[model samples]
Target: LAKTTQPISMDSYEGQEVNITCSHNNIATNDYITWYQQFPSQGPRFIIQGYKTKVTNEVASLFIPADRKSSTLSLPRVSLSDTAVYYCLVVKQAGTALIFGKGTTLSVSS
Candidate 1:
């Protein structure tokens, strides 16, 4: 599995757009970049994923550059409820248990 590096923390206000970038220089061709958010005392939940270019879903958007060395998870108009620890993971196979790095703690204030 590829190692992931992300910020230790971030701050944002309600209604602001938050972008967290993760770096995975050893990412393999078959690897997919996936982002998950975990609230305190809860399991991490999938937010978005992308192999290349961009992928968007109801909760968030994943942007992967051509090199696939780094990616960004974008949260739009974030609210206090969005405050959580966000994880960036490199997944190469399905049904594999999620491997987590020290996540980026996002603080959203009103």
Candidate 2:
């Protein structure tokens, strides 16, 4: 598994966009980048994913560079409800196990 690096905390304002980046310097070729969001007392939920280039869902967008060493999760027009710990993970194509790391806490204030 590739070790990921992310900011410990980030601050943003309501209705603003937030982009949290995670670095995986040793990412494997078969690995995919997955982003998960967790609230105070809840388990992480799948937010977005991508193998390369860009991927977008209703909640967020994930952008992966060609080298696959890093990825960014983009939240458009975020709100207070979007404040949570965002986790970036590198996983095998068919793997189900998730190893959580110290995630990036996004603080969205009014």
The alpha-carbon lDDT assigned to residue 101 of candidate 1 equals 94
lDDT of prediction 1:
0.94
TM-score of each: 0.96, 0.97
Q: Say which candidate scores most in TM-score.
A: 2
Model 2 agreement with the true structure over 31-95: per-residue lDDT tens digits: 99999999998989999889999999899999999999999999999999999999999998998
Report, for every candidate in turn, its global Cα lDDT versus the true structure. 0.94, 0.93
**Candidate 2: C-alpha RMSD after superposition:** 0.7
Give the top-scoring candidate (lDDT).
1
- lDDT tens per residue, model 1, 41-78: 99999888889999999999999999999999999999
Steric clash pairs (candidate 1): none
How displaced is residue 94 in candidate 1, in Å?
Answer: 2.4
- Give per-residue lDDT, candidate 2, residue 91: 93
